[model samples]
Target: MTRVRGTPSPSAPARDDVTSLLRHASLTRFLIARVGSITAQQMLMLAISWHMYDLTSSAWDLGLVGLFQFIPGLATTLLAGHCADRMHRGRMVAICLAAQAVTAALLVVSTATHSVTREVLLGLSLVLGAIRPFQMAGQQALLPMLVPPSLLARSMALSTVVQQISVIAGPALGGVLFAISVVTVYLTSAALFCMSAVMYAFVRYDYIPSPREPVTAESILAGLRFIWRNPLLLGGISLDLFAVLFGGATALLPVYAKEILHVGPQGLGLLRSAPAAGALCVGLILSRRAIGSGVGKKLLIAVAVYGISIAGFGLSRWFPASLLLLAISGGADTISVIVRQTLVQLETPDRMRGRVAAVNTLFIGASNQLGEFESGVTASALGVVGSVVLGGCATILVSLMWSRLFKPLATRDALR
Candidate 1:
């Protein structure tokens, strides 16, 4: 892992420490809504997946849940980014949450009436698919408004902490609630989404609305053009796309659990959470002592470390060693993620943030979804262990190649 340079410089303005940043009411409220909505959304998805599998025991039908969600998101995300820039972003966020809440509420009614089916669930997944791109664009673009520029890095770190915790907790909470009753889980998620929506409505921030640009192909493609023109942004964003696209080690946890480790479903659950747990720990540390100088080098090194960690895991036979390797990989990833996000957000102008964030979000989504598919196909051809090891090596090589290709990203000393 890359070493932390030091604590916040005493001479720096805005008192950019975790406690001071968290003291801001607007930032606090945004975080609360972010965690709430994300958790509820994860729980909602978990319940829906289980519901679909319970109804139809076919693996193909179970797979349609992701396919349904991805198709709509791919189609509408660019448009959603435009909407984020042209509208009250907070209101866009609120509307998205409300829409999700309505979907969950409908599920509760459908489940009660015994009318819920796989088709119904998939259709609702499509609705979620359409709404999330807007929600994500709004949320990313709004955070810069809630804090001073000096504090933005720490704020991003802290936000990552909340996000990792929510990702870990959401599914566990939903699983427990689901064991009691499916409808009960859906009801709770709906209430949480409603709470999140109301909180976002009350949250206030300073935003200078951009003058409405006439809709054109150029307007829609502005984000892409901007990223292409900027080496730093292109390197940071593409690094994630390729690194995650290759280093999808976790997607094969089931094989490790059943065949290699001799553990069952319970162990798979523990294995799945290890990455988030590691990420949460690192995020907490970064929240206080944010990464300082040598930002670009650290970012590259972190990706290399992550790839190495994945390779290490591919060879581990013991459960404890496997868990540690996975944790290390997650921690390394957290470093790269914070650095990339800070650079992307700080370097981009406010007017272009929505569009930039949309492209960023698109790459993130595509990497995750396709990364699993890549893993699956490779596992079939090369065998699971061989696939994972080769992928990790490829990730390391990519990091090396990126250093030469994006010298500005690799040689930079500060995010600002």
Candidate 2:
């Protein structure tokens, strides 16, 4: 049968893909909780970083905050992953969020009582860090259950957008509140976490228990083996791991605000928020459009762009120029994130998602916290600008090397 000359195709309705995904009740509730909890976490991070720097005025101390948080996460990765696969994910997440809320509340009380100390902050970081992996692994595994397989990419993209939005708003709000009173920032964060817990309680999804396997070294090692066996997954995770490890500039933002940029707390907030704003914009675009073919090449190109932008930011003295560069870097990074996360989730089985996600979390923790520690140490030796510029250059080199090393990843044509 011949088609009409001006007739639209069957795929015309697909233009509203993101809206369709959001219509799922479970997914919608999850997104709301994700946004609120993530925003509060971001806000708390800024407040803690600022407080630490104000207390010690040392880059090493700033780095130590990340290190402190990371140690607990590292120590708990395997066990957390195993638990997520077997446990009630919603309840697990709710409990973790409640713990965080309590931590924030403690901070509020400490600040109000004139008893806030670096030791207390570090201790709280350790607690939160320990709980974070389980929370993340459960959430990652739970996501697939909320939507059909066809909508998985869109769901991930939308979830990322919510996270980016939180990143944008959280720090800005924190900065303003922090300027008024540290206690106010802590109290606000605690309230937000409580709100997120309530939302998590309302999310409804059918849980499927994975095949029972005795908890042992061999069972725990399965996730690592799976990632190792899949070259594409290995490459994607390592690329992100190395790129962020070398290119991270966040740890030194306070230095830029005080010594180099000469902008105070508000300016620091802008600096921190710039990247997330950029990521949010990109996430919105990707939610409407697919990445299409040549996924591997696109990921590599985005990472290289991220490195170049980061280096540009490092060298820029003007605040506006720096913000623009960081935004560019953030946008580029968002592309890579979407690609990597899609690859991991689509490739892994539901039963194994938690463990695989846990491994992914380890890479993330290393790239972020360990990277911050690296940045701090290097900054102490090379100065802030020099360290950032060098790290960015290293990131560019990593993208180039990884492209040649992981041929499968470079040659990948589709996410699935």
Candidate 3:
């Protein structure tokens, strides 16, 4: 396998040494690419949700939007994964961004014409979601190629930070724009998507996707087999899958803004961004410091912290307490994400990265939307506080169960 220059090859001394880890130039370029994409994604999501709710005034509509996006991921993931492996990664990303741009344009046009409907928005969301797995899988697959195996963790950490920034800024910006005019928000999102497309166009990597052997059932199954066989990948992904599926608190933010918390639109925006702010802080810290020898243990512990923080947030009636708890939860969740992303990038091969990453996207997308669904349904049944608190508790319980069932993921050697 060809390695990027100025990087410590896997054969080199362990990357515990800081000097060796900081030498790669491609890492910078790779991070730039990820940041660009993440910023666009965050902005788009923020704008879309804001517009959707403004038009529909229904929590069920929001839940349905989440569902629309996630359902397509279930269908296109393997096929997208296969394409990622067979095609050029950079071009594939470019194509995805272009598609996003088109979607954004359509949204703008629809909104401008006052022709936007919940059904149209939901249909567009599903299409975007279908293409999302491929984009995400392609990017994850391409990262390892840009940097050395040893720095994969750090690279993912940096990307996480950038994403957090996007998360923080996007909604706040979207909210401001939405207050000005819904059409303005849509236009801004479209512009951001175009900016991302342009940034991706400038990435000068030789990213021809790896060519796998001829297509067959066995070839398609190869990626799944690899993920299934790898204890670390399976355990980490699964742990997050169940953990986030129950613990995710996003769906309730709208409710908090509208009813329980009584903070209003600004509060809603802040609530949306609270987790990302915490994650951004954690990301900055991780970028400078090594994750240490016990990254596995740290990941588990961080998630536990996430659960505790979320539970605390759920129980809080005070706005400040709620915000602080949510921020803390976000920080803890960031740690788990960095660890998981690092392990996946390091362990998966370039050829199968798309498939594995698509699978990863599937889990993530499912957890995100399903979490929303679970929250929505449970909230409808149990009240907001009860639902959120229960979800947080379920996350902790799931973590404990996963630790017992897949204890090997908690060791550093599993990653190696």
Candidate closest to the true structure, highest lDDT: 2
Model 1 ranges off by over 4 Å: 1-12, 48-64, 106-122, 249-269, 314-319, 376-390
TM-scores for all candidates: the values are: 0.86, 0.95, 0.92
* Candidate 3 vs. true structure, TM-score: 0.92
Cα lDDT tens digits for candidate 1, 1-416: 11112323324576546778777788888899988997898678767765775687433454466557667888778877787788878888999999999999999999999999888988988888788888888888888777767778898999989988876777667767756788988999999999999988877865556787887878878988999999999999999999988987655665676678976544654566677778999999999886889999999999999999899889989999988888888899999999999988888888888889888877776666457657767777788899889989989998999999999999989867
For candidate 2, the lDDT comes to: 0.87
Give the distance in Å from residue 228's predicted Cα in candidate 2 to where it truly belongs.
0.9
1-416: candidate 3 lDDT, tens digit per residue: 45765556676665544344445655555565666566667667766665677787666677777888888888887777787788767677778888887898888898888888888989999998898988887777777776666666766777788789888887777667767776776677667666666655555445554555786777766778898999988999988888888898786787777677887666877888889899999988887676777778888888888888888888888988888898898899988988898888778767678788878878898889778877778877887888889988988888777777777787664344
Q: Lowest lDDT 10-mer window, candidate 1?
A: 1-10
Model 2: per-residue Cα lDDT over 1-416, one tens digit each: 11212323323343456877767778888999998999899899999999889888999988888888899988898777888888767777888899899999999999899898889988988998898898888888778777766667777788889999999899999989977898999999999999998888777776655677799987777788999999999999999999999999998999999889999889999999999989999999988888889999999999999999999999999999999999999999999999999899889987788899889988898899889999999999999999999999999999999999999999999865
Q: In what order do the candidates fall by TM-score, top score first?
A: 2, 3, 1
Q: Of the candidates numbered 1 and 2, which has the greater TM-score value?
A: 2
Candidate 2 to truth, TM: 0.95
Assess the local accuracy of residue 250 in candidate 3 as a C-alpha lDDT between 0 and 100.
84
User: What's the distance in Å from true for residue 253, model 2?
Assistant: 0.8
- Model 1 scores a C-alpha lDDT of 0.81
